[model samples]
Target: MRISTRTSISIRSCHVRRNGPHRSSQNAWKWVASRSSVELAGTGGWLLRNGKGLAYPTPAKSNKSMRSGTLIVLFQPNEERLLSAKAMIDDGLFQKITLPSVCLAQHCVPTKGGTIAVKPGRVLGYLDSLKFRLSEGARRHSCGTFHTGTDASIIPDYADFQLDVRTFSENTQKLAKAAVERIIRKECEVAGFPTTPRMVTVVSSPAIYNDAVATSQFTRVFEWYYGRRASEVVQEMPPDIVADDLVLLALPPGGMPIPYVYWNIGVTDPETWERVSREGELRDLPPTHSAIYAPAIEPTLRIVIEALALAALTFLQLL
Candidate 1:
């Protein structure tokens, strides 16, 4: 290292060049003299220019990268509610929710940006939430007061969203239809599906979603496969229909009990339905409670006794 007469300086030192901060050329020779040992490892403390500290290397697999995605669907009024329900079932979302999948009506909210899917067990909740966004498609579905100023506004455009709920309801209904049929047929143990056909009819075509589509679909599916024909109820079809969930058999004319199906696949034949209602003081019992219980022991015992008595009477008459 040397200094020019004009006072500029030059130094030959890659260490200083690589490490920087040689002060001035005046100490260049001094450093070279002491340069006996100065080795650097790839430590970030290279020149130590940054005393503020540095960041450690982070792993590539962050939580943001691994988090599950959320899904939401938008609805236009004309489309049936079941379309989304079916989409979820086909994709297995209800399994994710772990609830009895039903044809529940949904309301959409076009919020800050995304639309939220609001599913209330009862149709009223969905309707109330839908008002959050005034949809161009929401027509005929009036929300207002009725005569006497009674708030009859809750009754929705039954048709408007009836189909929407089919996705949830009919899926359950389809199950209900099969279970009721089986209970009637005496194929399955009564403990699982002890409801009468009368009660079963009421729940499947529940007054709420009981439009022509829901009613006829549920009734047709159940009756065709396992119910007794006319000589009993209205027009009847042959009993070749496919029955699932449980298999039912044809009842004697006016002999079949109505069936009631709950979302949980809990079922009730009519006699059991009445017994449970009269048995329990609580109206708040879940839809599945009666369906889960054994047909009362008393009733079964009575039937057995009656059958024995009839047999003895028949024997005596024959003699």
Candidate 2:
């Protein structure tokens, strides 16, 4: 993709397929990063293509990189499970590509087709998942699932369920954890349980905290690019409950955390957006994970490519 500037800005793009296990992708990453230090890097696995499943593309192994700085695009393999960032790190991701000065990530949101949203500080929430198993008891209480005698005439004695808690603050997370445990125990006690319920933590991840200064800087760049449509296209939003492990990409093996920004690009089809807006039904739009969720093909991809290119240039100081 080429962006018009005093000196035309050209971005090289490439694709790497994970042939073997997860580590195979890491090896491919090493091959790409072997050339030079990555100045501006963008990593994400959520973006979709016109047909079939998701697409994974990198900005290396093309003709050559930018004259001033190298821009490498990394794809995290398991972002939905919230394990991709840590998994990549465990496979020695940083050893190949030196830690970038700034990392960037973006997701397709349910907003209007031509708009983008940016939040400065803690945008996403912390996630904690727990599994609970209630011991056999004379009485039964409501849970995610219950098991009992073979016949429906008998009362259920055992139950098990999994719960995930998301919070934006440390104090709230602590309080939530305590409250979950207390409620589980109290419910089992009230139902006359024979033994204490077993509660086990399945997984925990920190919130996605965007660097305030970097986010603000990116907002300025976006506003400048949009010009008259700046107010309509660029949205400053509040913290959301959507949680991701992308922040882990900023921390080097043993070094300090680097600055990064993870924003959202709207992908709803323009016609659908307009109809929903006209009917005041925007709140009913399908979100990212909904079964019926599908983003438009044209403007969404256009914005993603343009936004990514602009972000890379901004960090490279070529803008």
Candidate 3:
């Protein structure tokens, strides 16, 4: 019996490994392709690397055996601006890859380290950019040139600028946009402009509402992995930064609404987090768009990788 036992044991081992408690072949997974218009801030590239499994694996090919689901990384051009995700879709992203059972993404925040933030409902608000163009006479005679202290003599014609509006609810967004347009038209009428100040929406981003059930389950798994360090907070996003990718994943044609979780990892160091906590404000922290807004790299990268990995593993669990 010993002569033939080794072959039988090897076969059993392979079968058990493939259908192991940790392995999953039931559902496919997708990671958003990472491309950026601007140079990334501290440790921002970590998301692209870690999400693609480049950081943890020794050799890239080693991931093939363990990988059960399709991992999609969306591609974007360097010159592409807003609506990057939409560009990917229009380019046939869905047609090229297997639709995912779930989508996951993470972002860096200036909050304290070792903490996670999850808002179950309406994590992000709808965003719209309105640009108003004033005619030359409207600018000089009616609106007047914007006074710059250093350059007061500079007079401009055909003034154009963009305004952003964010709304928490979908209906509110529509109402607000319409109301804004009406108010602007009325203002132009009062100002006696030759033509109604032309209003154009340059960018529109839909609101992101996380699935309540899925978010709760994922949060539980996060806490189980990271313990008390993991907790939720309400984080305000900069008006210009919209999670459009998440929006794309949630909507139809691409696929049905899949469970997705977009979480944040704190970039500030322990020392800075403590100081800011004592001060009771984020004033000391650099604003996200500032040139000096560099996050603590090492700890931030570690936490981000851990958070993303935990979510993926939990979703792929066999039992």
Whole-model lDDT values for every prediction: 0.24, 0.65, 0.53
Model 2 scores worst on lDDT over the 10 consecutive residues at 2-11
- Best-performing candidate as measured by TM-score: 2
Per-residue lDDT over 28-129 for candidate 1, one digit per residue giving the tens place of the 0 to 100 score: 323322331222222221111111011100111122253232111111111212132233334644344322111211111111111111111222111100
Q: Against the hidden true structure, what lDDT does model 3 obtain?
A: 0.53
* Per-residue C-alpha lDDT of model 3 across residues 28-84, encoded as one tens digit per residue: 112222221122222222232333243322221245566555444332322123455
List the candidate numbers ranked by TM-score, top first.
2, 3, 1
Clash pairs (backbone) in predicted model 2: none
The alpha-carbon deviation from the true structure for residue 319 of candidate 2, after best TM-score superposition, in angstroms, is 1.2
Off by over 4 Å in 2: 1-66, 137-158
lDDT of 2 by residue, 136-212 (tens): 74433433235434665555566667889988897899899989999989987996777999998876788888888
| Residues forming the 10-long window of minimal summed lDDT in candidate 1 | 1-10
At residue 228, candidate 1 shows an lDDT of 55
Query: Against the correct fold, how does model 3 do in TM-score?
Result: 0.71
